[model samples]
Target: MLDARREDLGRMLRAWRMARDPGLLPGPVPFRGHRSYLTQLDMALLLGVSERWYRALERGEDRTYAREMIAGVVRILDLSPRQATALYRGTGHQPPRHRAGGARPDAALLDLLHQQRRVSWICDQAWDVVAANTVAARHCPWLMHPETNTMTWAFSAEARYQLREWDTKWAVPLLGQLRLAWQRWPDNERLDEVVRTVRREPGVAELWEDTTGVRGDADDAARPMYFPLVAPDPLDVRVATYGRFGDTALRWVVLSPVDPSVVFP
Candidate 1:
């Protein structure tokens, strides 16, 4: 906390409290204080903290506070993202992400995807295809499928037809990355389901158990792709992956067009 800005934090908190209209809220509610603004006692009870602790936080006093207590205030106050971030900073802590908020496709990330002229899409930590731009949807049809788990698609027979040397080029590297992700976030339900789903595919269970192709991400090497399809596909594509959105740990997969000399499927 900036010592000079202590009173600044207090003033902001009081102002925010006054600005909040309790009448607009739904569900069983606590009685409002004078002039219908929430009181320190009401805030304390809503935040599940002691009245003394709540008073200290309101005044931005020099006492330590738990992250949950601060997060509770954010939830109860219904702070905007900017306000939540400022509150966390004022308390000398980085803002906590709403875990479920990261689950939905981020609009800013979707904007980033469409900004690319090349084929591009974004996936969350579990490799669930959250958003793919028009080019990506057109070029990599699998991305737009209702079942857009990359692991499931990579292990399926469709991948064999789409990718040249599927086992060595695509499956190996992809499985390695999925395995590493599962190891890092073993409890992630969607990722676990992806693991189970891919294993159900023929020979994939054996592949999952092997120690080979233990890569963290895709390499820049040009790989052949083919689409015997309903529409025209991009010519000579190379895979490039970028990790953006450190908070959500979202990955951007770009298919950059290369010279025609790239290997044919």
Candidate 2:
């Protein structure tokens, strides 16, 4: 099975190499009168590795791989973000994080939040509330704060009281997301701080460590919630998260009532 994976990656790499634009190749083009597609020798020279080593990777031989080796391949080939991610994952390594949460959402994107009458907010890759509609603000007061991180707030002591089935239903899935995010953006200080803060809280560390609990998102079931407005009654909501094609930093988190008859302020 492992051998099959390696062969598949080798073939994929060859295909991407074939598809590369000839004009993008760095250094002088190889001497056999270049038409299209860089030779393995060209790739080896540019990657600063021996021709034999590069061949092993391309031929799916059992050879040790280095992070920088793959990084060099990415640069030399000018791989797209998606392509780069595929390469890293293929090599059984975590891809370096991109600047997904760095840019502020443009006016048009922010307008989306303002236009929504539902309990909706926009969060960055770090899960910081970039913008929130009035309806969302009423339910999550922390969103009004300029620097509020939704992830941090959600993992806080107070969240236990508001989020129903806080452990299995909510925390488990969310922790999975947190783990993946941090793995991608290992250098993100804010995300690092959030992990630390949550780990320090009693029992949270245990939850974070439960590998079985890691999930991609926290919306598989209705998130039973409680708030002053819904006092004595649970405000069940279905969560949905959205992201644009090229915008990695922008995520739209919306909550719709489980019962269509329910409406938000």
Winner by lDDT = 2
Model 2 lDDT tens row, 38-60 = 77887776566788899888777
Give the TM-scores of the predictions, in the order they appear: 0.54, 0.59
lDDT of each: 0.67, 0.72
Error of 2 at 139 (Å): 2.0
The positional error of residue 27 in candidate 1, measured at the CA in angstroms, is 36
Number of the predicted model whose TM-score against the real structure is largest: 2
With candidate 2 superimposed using the best TM-score fit, by how many Å does residue 66's alpha carbon deviate from the native?
49
lDDT of 1: 0.67
Q: What is the lDDT of residue 236 in candidate 2?
A: 81
At residue 23, what lDDT does model 1 achieve? 41
